[model samples]
Structures are given as C-alpha cells and as structure tokens.
Target chain A: MAAAEAAGLIAVGAGLAVGLTGLGAGIAEGNVGAAAVGAITEDASLFGKAMIFMVLPETIVIFGLVISILAIFVM
Target chain B: MFKRSVRKGNYAYTVTRVKAKKSHLLREEDYDKMIQMSVPEISRYISEAGYQKEMADLAGKYEGMELLEHATYQNMANVFNSILGASQGELATMVSAYLEKWDIWNLKVILRGKSYGLTGNGIKEDLVPAGKIDEAALDKLISLESIDDILNEYSRMGKVKFPADVISDYKESGNLGVIEDYLDKLHYQRLLDSISPYTQPTKIFLDYIRRDIDVVNLRTIMKLKSEGIYGEKVMKYYIPGGMQIDSKFAQLLANAETVSAAAGDMSRLDVFEEYIKPVLDFDNYDNKAVVSAIKKYQEDQAKKMAHMYPLSVLPVIDFMVHKETEVRNIRVVARGVNSGLGRETIKGLLVI
Candidate 1:
C-alpha cells in the first residue's frame, strides 16, 4: 500500500534468503572442510585440490547472496 | 566390556588417515626390489621404508631374518593399535571388534603351543598385541599351566565358555583344530551381537565382514575337500554370518567330491569366484594355489570397497588388510631368500 513498507518487506525477504542459504552452505562445508584438511595432512600436495573441493559448496551461499542483492535492489 | 555410541563424524578423519597410510603400503615396485635383494638387504630396505621407527626398538635384539620378522609383526600390531586409538565411539567399537581376529590369532598360537607342550617363553614371541586383549592378558594366558585355566581366563574376559566335553575331546584327540574352530565361531558371534546390519555406516562394515566370512568359508571348504575329508568334517569349520554363500552353498561345497568342483560351485555363487577361475586349475585343484587365489580376491574386494565407500570405515579396514598382507609377504620373502629359494619362487608366494 505504501512505498516505504514495500521496500522494508523486500529487505526482509532478501535477508531471510541470504541467511538461510548461508546456513545451509555452512552445514555443507563442514564435512568437506574436515575431509579436505585430512587429505592435506596426508599429502600437502593436495592442498590446492582439497581447497577447491572444500570451497565448492560455498557456491550455494554465493548464489543466495546474488539473489539477495537482486531482491534488495531490483525488487 | 564393549560399548557402542554414534561416532559417524570420526569416519572422515579416520578414513583420511587410513588412505594416507594405505598409499604408503609396499607397492609392486617395492616387492620387485625386495625379491631381488638378499635377506639382510631386504631387512635394510624395509627398515629404511615404513618400518624404520618400529625397527629401531627391535634391531638390537634380532638380526637378519629374525629381526625382519619381529620388526614386521611388531609394526603390524602397533599400526593396528594406533588405528584403534585414533578411532572413536561406534567406529572404535566396530574396529575393536574387527581386530579381535588378532586376539583370536594370538590365543590360537598360544593354545597350539601349549598342546605341543611348548613353554610360555616360546609362545610369547608369537603373540601380536594388536587387539583389545592387552599384552599382560596375553602373557597371563600364555603362562597358565592348563587349557582349562586358559579357558577360565577367557571366561573372565567375558568370552564364551567352551564346553567341558569339547576340552576333553581336544585332550583325548590332541586336536587343537576343535579349539580354534570354537574360538572363530565365538568371535563371529560377538561380532554379530555388537553391530547391527540395519544401521548406517555399520551396514557397509557388516557387508565387508560377510564377504570376508565368505572367503574364509571358501578357503576352509577347499582345504578340507582337497584333504579328502567330507560331509560333517567340513561343516565343523564353517563360520556363520556369511552373506554371499549361505549354509546351503557351504553344505554343497562340503559335499563336493573335489576341490575343483567346489571352486566351480563357488564361482557360480558369487562374482568373487569368477575372478578365482583363471587362477584355479579345475583338474589340479592345488590347495595352496586356491588359498592364495582366495586371498588375492579378498584383497581386490577390499580395494573395491575402499573405492566404493571412501568416506566410511572401508578404507581403514582395507588398509589393515593390506598391511597384514605386506607383513606376510615380507616374511615369505625373507624365509624364501634365507633358504636359498629362487626369486621367481619367492615372487610366486607374494600377494602383490
């Protein structure tokens, strides 16, 4: 009904989207990070590869961040 | 005495460490070098390799082949003990149970020594302190004067009490096979009681154990059938809990006229035997060849399991199996070389 209220509601939606997705990403990265560290410990040469695998799940959070940005600015 | 708690988180760390260790196990190239070298040189090579730290303690007391065997067995036991120490909760429980084979192994050696009237000092060297049964307990079991006393100690340890009749049967018949078979069945029962096949993580482990049981039962049938003993005699050695080959298949294998026929029947039961066909000569049915072939198949199965379930306990179990095989192969090489056997003959005995 009002422009200010609409903007506030949009901000809330963006925050929820990013926050929940970030939490999910953290949960996913926990196991991968543990396994990657284990691999690196065995062979330091795996550091690069393990880092790549460990960070792969962070893409979800990045996607959420992009969606939040669009919702906040464009919507 | 045994406890089970959910420790699924520990598998990642344990499996990773296991993979690292597995990568360091003696490869084909190492065996190539080992087979070419003399016994003393083989000892030097093993010492310079993964057995270095363990060899440090035993190097002074033993030399040549004796030193190598002692160092290899000690390292195997210590590595397994370290693995048990590294694990946690349910993983620890399952690993502990899986490792009870070493306890059973040590106990059987002791019992066999006693039956042969060998002294405690003689038996001590053969005991591997790799399982939950500590060194002191093993020493105590070794020191006991009678079989009844040993069984009492086992009972105190919460193990099943072998019947008086069986002990008398062993005494009268002077056959230690009965006791060893009883111990194996007890170990299987304890394993079944501790972990449920319905649970996650453990299901994979149970599957591995079942496959192992299948291989062991196959080996037993082959050995007995080759020896010309059939019917109930073969059944005496069958350890339950095998999934791939049921009691019926085992019975059929028991009744099979020859080892080759049994191996043929076994190959039809599962893919495990499919790999054994080429190595197994249908007409000859050499028991030693069949034993090695089955061992090879089990190792391959373990490797497949590690690849299939990298994040589970399969990797650790695979590592344990590989390590044991490495130790055994080194022993074979050492013995073969010391006795002036040719390199090709020694290589034939190797699992790698």
Candidate 2:
C-alpha cells in the first residue's frame, strides 16, 4: 500500500510540473506566433517560412511531455 | 489588436508576424546593387518591390533626398505602430516604451530646428512615427505655440516631466542641448523605471542603453575636447544614466580613468565591449566615428536581444531594429547616388 501511495504522489507531482511547463511554453510560443503572423500579414508569401520559426518553440513543451510520460508510464 | 499589456500568449502571435517580414529585408546583394543605382533607378527599384505604395504617395510630394526621407519615416512608423497594434498587454507595453526612443530623436529635431528657424514643415519631414504617443499627440506637438505647449500635451499622455522652466530659460539662451537633455533624461528614466521588475531582462536592456550612452557621451567628449569646452561643461550636457556613464562614472572618466579600466568596467556591465572597445583603441577610425558607433549600436543590440526569453518581444524588437537599419542603408545609398558619393561612404553608413 505504501509503495502504491508513493507512486501516486510521484505521478501527481510530475503531472503538475508538466502543466506549469505548458503554461510557460504557451507564453514563450505566444510571442513567436504573434511575430510570425505579423510578418505574414505584411506579405502572405512568408507563410511557409514563418511557420517554421513559429513551430520552433513546440519542442520545449514536447520535452516536458516526454519527461512526464517517462516518469509516469515508464515505471 | 493589442488593447492590453502582453501577459502570456501574446508573444507567439507577434513573433509569427515578425518572421514573415524578416525575410523581405534587403539582402547584401540587393544593397550592392542599390549602391550602383541612380536616384530615379533606386526609386524605381523600391517601387517594384515592397516600398511601392509609399514611393507612389511620396513620389509627387517630394523628390530626391526629401522624398526618400519622408517615405522611410512613414513606412517605419507604420511598421512600428503595426507591432504595437498586433501586440497586447505587457508585450505592447515594452515595445511602446522602447519605440519612445524615436520621440526623443524627433523632439531633438524639433528643438534644434526651431532654434535654427527651420520651418515646421522642414522639421516635420524627419520625424519617425512610433514612440507610443498617438499621431494626434505628435500633430499637436508640430502645431504647438511654445515648448511649454509640447510639454503639457506630452504630460497628459505619459509620465514624462516637461522641464517647462528649463525650456523657458534655454529659449532665451538659444542653447539646444538644454532641450535635448530634457528629452534624453526623461526617456532614459522612464525606460529604467519600466524594466525594474524583470531583473535579468532589465539588466540586458540597460546594458544596451549603457553602450548607447557611452557612444553619445564619448562623441560629446570628443567634440567638446576638440572645441575647447571644459570636461565639466561637457559632462553637464552628457546625460548620465548608463551603468558605466552614470554620474560617478562620468566624473571618473572625466578624471582620466585608464582606457583599460573604463573598457573593463563597461564590458563587465554588458557586451558593450564590442562597441566601446573599438572606439577606445588608439587606432580607431576617426572619420565617420558617429556612423560606426550608431551602426554597432543597432547590430549588437539586435544580436543580444534575439535570444531574450518569452520570445514574443525579442522577435518583434529584432525585426524592427533590422528593418530600421534596412531603411537607413537604402536611404544612404539613394543619397550617395544623388550626391555622387563613392560606394565607400554609402557602405560606411550600413549597419550590416
């Protein structure tokens, strides 16, 4: 029972951190997205190019998600 | 679109827009070609590309240098205010404040022009349209009856103190630096106060400011030292706010701090070393010193700021700096062709 309880606690903590990490990533990505779209609005031909930079920040959140899944599911 | 200060999600949208515009900036090859074009050819090249609408609008109203100057400021204002419009909350807030650097430039133009009896129309052509204050506010500025009128109007829109008494005194003396210092000091104080909450970001931001201050202070020192103005008087007009050039540092510098000590403290303060050290060296370029200093200011600030966190602000800020440099280089090339200047003069003005 104690072992099960400790695992549950660990899962909840990682889950919480993942949630906060998403929030920070959202803030980070928000700025890039705004600038990306802003550039597109000036010239639509930039759509493809802007998309690349806009997606660059997604890896941060992906890293967080990977760590969280490793901690919860790998065990 | 931004009605509030940037908070969380605002950065992504703005950075998105900035990236698209970044691709359109003049490449080095384009600049090379621009150097060889005649004035009309330069105008035609711009019209064929992105500057068409502005070139058309300005083509009739002015020509040569005047036309180029007006179109540049208009596009610049549009881009700057566009960033503000696209941002909201804290993101818009910081961008708006920094753009105020242009207002300090504009106001200096006005006060100096007014002192020289240059017409309002002549003075108006050079003004950049950003700086957080509204167009209506800037319009009110151009039509003002007195410097006090400008001050009172600015006070309503923001927290800048208008040195009304100083304006009156300086009007009689016809000393332009008095008015320049007021605008400079007000802008610097506001910038410093705004960035207090974010320690690392503020430090990084102020380091740019310090490097900028060092350049201005050094130029003033050089000019004064040559003109026989005492260091004390030179120090007075030298606005002291930068970490390295603040009051005590200025005094120490005035007292002849070793070039290494001054350079060491400044490099410690920020990556300003790249900008400061070149000029501090014994064999630094004496000709076109201001152009080099200002160009390094723009380029280094761009590199340092590109890595800032919360990526929204940095991308926009980076694009604006790059765009401004682009316009400036084009203008330099255009003017060089008109004046029969060699490519070296035009190239000297280019930041990239």
Clashes of each: 0, 39
TM per candidate: 0.85, 0.76
Evaluate fnat for each of the predicted models and list the values in order: 0.54, 0.93
Lowest lDDT sum, 10 consecutive residues, model 2 chain A, at A28-37
Model 1 Cα lDDT, one tens digit per residue, B182-267? 88988877876667666655687787788888888887877777778888788888989898778888899899878766655776
Taking the tens digit of each residue's C-alpha lDDT, what string does model 2 give over B126-231?
6776777666767677777666666666667666666667778776887766767777777766765655455565456656666666666655655554444544
- Misplaced by over 4 Å in model 2 are A1-40, A45-75, B1-9, B113-120, B171-174, B197-202, B255-287, B308-312
Q: How does candidate 2 fare on TM-score?
A: 0.76
- DockQ, per model, reads 0.51, 0.44
Best candidate, TM-score: 1
A1-75 in candidate 1: lDDT tens per residue? 699899999899899888998888987786687677777766899899998888899899889889999998887
